[model samples]
Target: MGQIIIFLVLLGLGYFFGRMAESRHYKRIHQREQAYRKLLVMPEKIPPLEFSQHESTLVSGNVVISVDYFKTVAAGLRSIFGGRVAAYESLLDRARREAILRMQEEAKAKGADAIYNLKFETARIGQNAGQSLGSVEVLAYGTALIPTPDMRAERIARNNLVQGK
Candidate 1:
């Protein structure tokens, strides 16, 4: 009886804290998503014609996120029932979004107007992968398109024309 009580208590605590943390992370992710909306991300092997005058460089963002206690417990129970483990869905969503955001940050820092050929790689990380749930590592990579000097000059001239300068 005592052990059961302890388990319940821990489960409740895990649920409460996990929910709070998830909410906060989601809020932050939404805000950053909005901020980076203008930075184009595409998964095409060939860039559009407009990007032909640009220089390309590889960029990547990696993030490792651990499952909360509540999620792990819920997933274990879900596995026994042979049903979808919804608990892990949000965890993956957050990880993927965060990885993309990080990649966009790098591209922005390098003066990239857009990222093309976007790809993702994911791996499970833990000491005992078979027996226990572990952290998920998400990697987002792409080619950043930066305007070359000639392209920049042409853009400047075009802007001047539009402004009647």
Candidate 2:
């Protein structure tokens, strides 16, 4: 009886902390998503020819995320039941979104107007011989199109007048 009680207590603690951390991560992700909504990301092989004056360069972002202890235990049980593992699904979703956000940030830093030819690469990392899934790594890459020097100066001047600067 004592051992069972201890096990339950540990499970409860794991669930509580794991849920808190996941919630915080999701909140942060949503905030960043909203902040970067203006960044154009697409999977086309080539940007439209109408913007031929712009220059394109490669940008990439990578992120690694690990499952919490509670999630690992839940996934183990789910395997026995042979159904979907929602915990791992959410973990991957968060990692993918974060990777995209980081990529967008890099493009923004370079004054890119849009991203094209977007692609993703995923890998599993940090697993020992006997260990379960240790972590997931997500890489997002794309071509960033930046306006020409003349266009940038025009945009800056237009914005200055609009803001009364």
Candidate 3:
């Protein structure tokens, strides 16, 4: 009885802390998403011809997220029931979003106006002896278009000249 009581207490603590952490992570993701909304990220295989005046380079981001103890327990129960594992689904979703955000940040750092040919790769990492998924990894990659500084400067100069500045 004492062992059962201890187990329940631990489970409750895990659930509470897991929920809090997940909530905080989601809030941070939402804020970052809004902040990067102006960045153009697309899955088109070919960039538009008009934007080809710029140089294109590759950018990528990867993130690995571990499942909380509560989530792992929930997933085990879900597996026994032979149904969807909502806990794992949310974990993967969070990982994918984070990977995309990181990729966007890299592109922005490279002075890219847009990212095209976006691709995603996902994998389960760190499996335990029980074959349970220990963590998930997500990779987001794309080609970023960087405008030529000389061309931009010329265009600005032309505009200023036309405006009689």
Which digits, one per residue and each the tens of the lDDT, describe model 2 over residues 111-149? 999999999999998774655677999999999999989
User: What is the lDDT ranking, best to worst?
Assistant: 1, 3, 2
Residues 1-165 of candidate 3 have per-residue lDDT tens digits of 999999888888989998898899999999999988988999999998877899989999999998888888888888889989998989989999999999999999998888999999999888888568999999999999988998779889999999999
Please give the CA lDDT of all the candidate structures.
Answer: 0.92, 0.90, 0.91
Query: Which lDDT tens digits does candidate 1 get at residues 91-150?
Result: 899999999999999999998999999999999888355855678999999999999988
Which parts of model 2 have CA positions greater than 4 angstroms off?
Answer: 1-3, 128-131, 160-165
Q: 120, model 2: CA deviation in Å?
A: 1.0
Best by TM-score: 1
Q: What is candidate 3's CA lDDT for residue 52? A: 84
RMSD of each: 1.8, 1.9, 2.3
C-alpha RMSD in Å of predicted model 1 compared with the true structure: 1.8
After best superposition, candidate 2 residue 158: deviation in angstroms?
3.2
- Consecutive 10-residue window with the lowest summed lDDT within model 3: 123-132
